[model samples]
Target: MKRKSAKKTKTEKLGLIKNILLIILSFLISVALWFMGTFKDQTPVTRQLIDIPVTIVGENVLTDKNLYFNDIGDIKVNATIKGVSTAIFSVKIDEIVAVIDVSSYASGEYSVYPTLQNIGTAVTTTKIDSVDIVIEDIVTNQLDIALEVEGKPVRGYEARPDLAEYESTVSVTCKASIMEKIAGARIKVNVDGKRTAVTTTTNVELLDIDGNVINDPGIKLSVESVSVRLPISLIELN
Candidate 1:
């Protein structure tokens, strides 16, 4: 009876070990299934976005340093982004922001790398290695304003160019390279068929020393217009 009881106990122990192994295998299989379901699509994918605009910041720095930038017209670049398939595919062209800070840059051309923003967890490897940005030194000058007569007065009246009175000087602001080209500011008054003296304010034209109009969108004046008074002289007949 004792030998039989010992053999039964050994069998019971083997059964218990088998049962424990089965339970652990089942738990491991369930965990593997859950992990596969949760992260099956977590593999990263890449997408290319075109024409991503570049925004410049810290321009007040340039202003403080007396520097200016040219019209970098519609500046754009392409970026190769990588992330989870769902996240990367949902990225929009407008949502991605590329910025470059020009505060530390001096007056010259520079190849700048833009910092990407607004992309949650995605990564960017832009196609454009670096954008070429040109910084120019600003040149400001004070020029004397002159009154120019454009048209003749009525039959008995003659406009005297020398008798005109107006603002003496104005501050002209332009790029340093174009500063020497800008000579003087003049307001041309039209006195066609006018018997009375003209007194009003009008916009001035930037003229080179050779009397050619220098029109530039970047040019700014101290005032919008200059006041003028031109006295029409009556011609005397002998």
Candidate 2:
């Protein structure tokens, strides 16, 4: 009877040890699963994008109303974005588009909000609350086109931009503010190294009264370019 009791006690001790081992293994597995779940890219992320282009919509409305844009603030925007890690990290700058609608607006300055497009399932907040857009009534003008020479001809050659014959006049159209800044319009010609005459079409350039180049997109020319006939001759020999 003493030996039987001893054997039973040994068996019970073995069973208790097995149960404890099983519990420990289960607990370790649960901890490992928790760690995998936490680190498996299921986290949320936030990021910022800069210089994303803003698409201007409904500008044709202004044209239909005989109006035009004198100035539009930055065409690019910066925004903060938020989403799941994979989606947010995969977002591209070009794929993001900010848009502003001016259809309901008239000829005046407006502070407007822009909406986002193409950023999938991501929430966005723009850095700027509003963008300023300046619209005005359109004006038209008819001006004779001429040539403005840049760069001297190569040594021993002479270029006569003045003698260049292009008799076609162009129609200039813009806002009143831009119209006031324009004095004349001419085609820019480069005479840097011309051994012969140039008979090609060139883009028209707008100039202020001081002969400084006026680079405003608001200035619209009826004809973008005009035909030219510049004469070149040998002036000296080296």
Q: TM-score of each candidate? A: 0.74, 0.48
Q: Write the per-residue lDDT of candidate 2 for residues 77-151, one digit (tens) a residue.
A: 777777777777887767877888877777878887687787786554535445778888889999887677777
Whole-model lDDT values for every prediction: 0.82, 0.80
Model 2 residue runs over 4 Å out of place are 1-44, 71-74, 126-130, 139-174, 179-238
Judged by lDDT against the true structure, how good is candidate 1?
0.82
Candidate 1, 1-238: lDDT as tens digits: 9999999999999999999999999999999998986685587777777777899998899989889876677788777777777777676667887888899989998888887777665555535547898888988888888887887899999997788888868888877867788878888889998999998888877888799989888778897598888899889889
Lowest-scoring 10 consecutive residues by lDDT in candidate 1?
Answer: 120-129
The regions of model 1 sitting more than 4 angstroms off are: 1-11, 24-49, 81-94, 120-128, 177-183, 208-217, 236-238
Number of clashes found in candidate 2: 0
